[model samples]
Target: MPQKATAKFIVIEGLEGAGKSSAIALVRDFIEKHTGKAPVCTREPGGTPLAEKIRDLVKVADASDPLCDESECLLLYAARAQLVARVIKPALAEGSWVLGDRHNLSSLAYQGGGRGLMPLVSAVSAATLGDFKPDLTLYLDIEPSLGLTRAANRGELDRIEQQELAFFERTRATYLSLAQQDDSIAVIDASQSMAEVHKDILAVLQTKDW
Candidate 1:
């Protein structure tokens, strides 16, 4: 009998300015420090070249074109498909932990709940062949107002961030709902200081013994 191979795929998810990028970097550092191997760090909407182009269109494009929510949802999945095929799948098969800034859950929250593209979510999930599901997802929880403020301070708003406050409220609520429903997802309170948030994430990873 052969010993089973273990590969952990962790994702950091939250609304805009939830510090997902920083959290992912921290997790990568933690993994390297402990395991002597640097996990593969990447992000959705822009991992591979093609996907990145799509991401730019989705985020930076002017709003004059009148893009439908369903179309937006499909584009997300399209980018995801390319990313999985080109980057994530390969990294995971090589026994590297693939840390993603945002994964499928983001689509479920932003597109499905926030944009009211419920049917598109299921359609895209099925279309992607279900090849991507995070082994563990860390949802950085924060109040919408706080998150929005942080985002505004950062710089110009992207297409998604430009959405109304109510939109983000729905997005945040959806994230919380997912965390409650999924045992694999751990919600970390992100409203605390950066040091505290980092400590909370480290604690979660340690408890998981990953």
Candidate 2:
């Protein structure tokens, strides 16, 4: 038989309280059912050792010594570069599926829409990895306020998580716009109950349709 194609890179994206953690588990099981191989799960800014440290560095920022938005954007790209080169690429080469908690789209939504830095985000992504994208992206859409409420209940908010509700609205808008243009993205109504959301996600996964 001819050699099989590499397993796809699947990414899960959403606001803090959009049930991404639980959704990823569902995605993992879905991919395994189809491919008979367990997927590798990785979180942005902290897949590897150095990337984890970067995650910590970017997570907390003092109000007295806040990080510049531009610098914050660059650090995110740096960590992404490390994770992509170190983890994602290798896994795909070995033909194992990869499940990403967040990928390049997060930067576009958060740093671009929220921080008003789309140009910088675009330039960084193009320079670091031109035209590289996940095979499929599942965007869980939810109201910003509801999502924040879920996140707040989880634990203390991170630096970016502490942003005002307006910031998240802009971010969600950007994510929706991107999904509208990309066929590979499946947008799930995350505001629904867990069972409904999971069912929608499974439908997309089984059909391979957005």
Model 1 clashing residue pairs (backbone): none
Off by over 4 Å in 2: 1-4
- What does the lDDT read for residue 208 in candidate 1? 81
What are the Cα lDDT values of the candidates? Answer: 0.85, 0.90
Q: What is the lDDT of residue 29 in candidate 1?
A: 87
Error of 2 at 98 (Å): 0.4
lDDT of 1 by residue, 15-61 (tens): 88889878988998877776667888878888998999999888875
Candidate 1 residue spans exceeding 4 A from truth: 1-5
- The number of the candidate with the highest lDDT is 2
Clashes of 1: 0
Q: Provide backbone clash counts, one per model.
A: 0, 0
* lDDT for each residue of candidate 2 in 55-137, tens digit (9 for 90 to 100): 88789886787888998899999999999999999998898889999999999999998899999999999999798899999
TM-score against native, each model = 0.94, 0.95
TM-score of predicted structure 2: 0.95
